[model samples]
Target chain A: MMKNSLMRNVPENYNPYVSSDDYKSKKRVLIDKKATNSTVEYLESYSDLFDKLNITDGMTLSFHHHLRNGDFVFNAVCQEIKNRGLKNMKLAPSSIFPNNQCLVELIESGAVTDIYTDYANGPVAECISKGKLKGEFLMHTHGGRPMVIESGAIKIDVAILGVPTVDKKGNGTGKIGKSACGSLGYAESDVTYAKKVVFVTDNLVDTLDDYQLDGKYCDYVLKVDAIGDPNGIVSGTTKITKDPVGLKIARMTAKLLDEFGVIKDGVSMQTGAGGTSLAVAHYVKNIMQERGIKGSFASGGITGYFTDMLEEGLFEELYDVQCFDLKAVQSTLKNTTHHVMSGSRYANCFDDNVVDKLDFVILGATEIDTSFNVNVTTDSHGKIMGGSGGHSDTAHGANITVITTNLIKSHMPIIKESVTTVTTPGADVDVLVTERGIAINPLRTDLIEKVKDSKLPIVTIEKLLETAHEITGVPQKIERSKEAVGYVVYRDGTVIDTIYKID
Target chain B: MKRGTAGTLESNDAMIMVKESDGLKITITSIVYDFFHEQIENVIRETLKEEGLTNVEVICNDKGALDYTIKARLLTAISRMEEEK
Candidate 1:
């Protein structure tokens, strides 16, 4: 009886339902056969493809924004959805441009209930600022986007990719067509994970061999008359300001660079694409040209002006997260020196990233308070106007952060007793430059002493504040609400500051 | 130095000439290039086609005029012609 019980208690080595070694080998062989037979489908139009895909409510949709102000596809697609009375759709766009102003209408119509993107500019940011979306707007760095997709945090349902050129097999390229905008780096993550990937192109090729995006992953292809304007593709050349007042500030910033002793060989720096910041770049370029110095690298939103410096041998390399203009895109495509950086590699502070190596960074500000807190969001009227696009990240990472702005814009003083909202911490900002003078943060006394002998205009932070107040009688204190409208996230995704609704 | 009186046009095309101020004499010529080259010429011709044979020659000093700006200037000049009569 004991022997009979032991035989009954013996466990089976494997179940029939579970795949054994032989079953696994057979499954792999089947997958290989299917892969070889896989073929791409071509649809007559965008609408036809959408109908076939059956894009339903609560579906996750994505868009690429290589065309900044010139983009029309995002708005067009959203408008179509709005007409169809779709609701609760999640927009997981790589980025949103100012030209996609129609997104505001979609938000009003409740078609887009949630948004996840690396950056938002123009009216979409305005709507988000007004707390219009049903769900929270989750912001991610470029690298963070791919990471989230890989982790299945953001599973894409339908990715509507805007291609400059595409093949019949659904292969796509953005560098050669009439509206060529360059590398499809941002769309790489979506194509990998999306359940259905659609390529919308103006120029359709006969074959898939020349396309940069692999047709093996793409499922459907659609053709249109025009994708976007080539001129609008590179709307701004990322030029430096040549204005007198701007030049003075640029020169002062260069002097500060000299004083801080970060102007030597193998140093790295970053600057914004704004006119004044670009002016600082030009001045820095002049300094490098004169001293026979070379920088290790430059990083951030790469522009033509910065690309020119990289090509001119001022810097050994350019780590570009996103190309802002045609020149930048061309250089990134042709030149080996220009390296493409993923968003996570660019500024995700949670991860050990490349921004930590930055020696200096020049930024622009809308208002600066006496305590050195900088505000890039909200105007004097407390209206939500701007975004914290990589502002807090650069300020926190760089050893020296210089802010440039005129003392007054349109007869209104920019220096206030307290900023409307603090986008960058007071501790991070080292210097503030105005057309009239320069203000060194008191916390950075060492920088002040270093530049004491320089001919560049230097003044105390208090003095600059006083001067601004003297011109335009001190601004009345703004009353803020306790209810938060939006949150300013630091590079590490921490809540740096919260915005209240405009009263 | 060549001297000429510059005039402002009223809504009814009445000319109000003013004396020139002293400064560096500079003339700025503006050329409006459309995204499509033909659109610009078509716009200029369509707006000015209706006006009668004109004696007043307008030296367009363009700094960088948008499509609307070009149309407005041409219309204003045509309206000024009515005042001359």
Candidate 2:
């Protein structure tokens, strides 16, 4: 049984299906600190680090996706572990991208058995969806991962962080380096709470003046040839869609935002990095320029477009959790108003964060049902393609949550009778805007009444579904096995839906 | 064909033509007609009735305009037709 010093009435193996209200108020364990007086040796090779750390079977390890698809440290560490023949270890990454496909060999060799992550794409997710993993794949939201770890539900034996710059004393930062990927926010918990923390980087500097990760949290620091690919870490720029239909929806969305009266001064917002969602930013930019309105802040996955808005005085500040493009990285380092925050400060539900006070958030959805439940995890056939990185977290926290997607994607209707899996509950979602029309959740009578006078089309989700069916016809149901392969856990740690095996 | 016509083919805006007739007759061509035809026709009819003109022929070429934008365009055409009276 895990000992929770914060909660007095915690059950053994305390994992419960509780509501957000119940879960958010639970006691959380404080992070353990390591105080050592002797001079600690920080430099080591991969083999020496592994042996000294006593890499063993059935232990948990963590990694962060701040390096994104350019990351090379995860594969390097796993390779060393596999060479040492460690087995049955659990892999908890903040998120997994296509570059982490090397995990396939690690899983097949029995070196990795269980997996937990906020988001995943490409081969690893496909392998997990096919039940190739030894245990069920547990999916979490961006906020939920920190929540579970702080509650002592999952303990990490070691946390290997891939940083861009580090000193001899193990202090590190992702702000300035040849392979800089701004904001080491996602790895904050691993360094703070893990039993052992290791910093692996390619660029070694002599100074410790400006560092995001303090040397106290990290036990060892290792320098390598390359930590990540520069081209893959951050794109040159983020782009909006050229599709006319997408632009039309973006226009309507901007108009709707104005009608809601939240587009004025002091409004706080967060938008996804999708094409359509970025298009919403473009239209919103025009509206702000036209009205001379300056927003309080724009947060979340920061892109170059947002940085441009900051320079143009469209937004007063930009709160960046992760930098998605080069311009965003440069802006966070250059601008005083562009602030870098830890993951907990960004979206953890147990503690107060920026998400709790957001006025609006624009999200992308793969499927949305008549009840306003959303599925950003799977495709029409229930294959894993995306995950709830922060979709559910922001929706749960924001005053108004709007999902933007085309009515039909690849000849299949997006507004279904029900989603393949519910990533964000209907109660959290406030509105859905497609190219055809906008549907406000019946639960938000305040929004419906607010937009009732606007010329914008306000219709029921049922009406949108009917219109979709009229265009695409009823889609064929997806087939899957009876056994469950994955579990979609809501941000509060409740199992909202089960994903079946697709074979 | 004796009527008043105004506006252009701008995106998200509408062009309309109004002429005298024995009864109210309306024709609409819109790229978004499938989703908003009823809305466009209602706005056109309401605008004509609000101006106390019942016997008229209204032709609207809508390029996905909203209800209010369509109504404003129709009213502009109605006032133009009255200008030539």
Q: For this target, which candidate reaches the highest TM-score against the unseen true structure?
A: 2
Tell me the spans in candidate 2 whose CA falls farther than 4 Å from its real position.
A1-20, A31-40, B1-85
| TM-score, structure 1 vs. true | 0.72
lDDT of 2: 0.82
> What is candidate 1's lDDT per residue for A232-346, written digit by digit as tens?
7764577778778788878877877887798999989999888888888888888899999999999987889988888899999998766778888788667788776555566
Whole-model Cα lDDT of every candidate shown, in order: 0.67, 0.82
Structural similarity to truth (TM-score) of each candidate: 0.72, 0.82
Clash pairs, candidate 1, are A142-A343, A143-A343, A143-A344, B30-B62
RMSD of 1: 16.9
The interface root-mean-square deviations, each candidate in sequence, come to 17.7, 10.7
Docking class of 2: incorrect
> Scoring each candidate complex against the real one, what DockQ results?
0.01, 0.02
CA deviation > 4 Å runs, candidate 1: A1-41, A117-121, A127-132, A138-155, A166-173, A183-196, A204-219, A350-352, A442-449, A452-455, A480-483, B1-85
* lDDT accuracy of residue B51 in candidate 2: 91
Lowest summed-lDDT stretch of 10 residues in model 2 chain B? B31-40
Q: Considering every candidate listed, which one attains the maximal lDDT? A: 2
Task: Score residue A461 of candidate 2 by CA lDDT.
Answer: 91
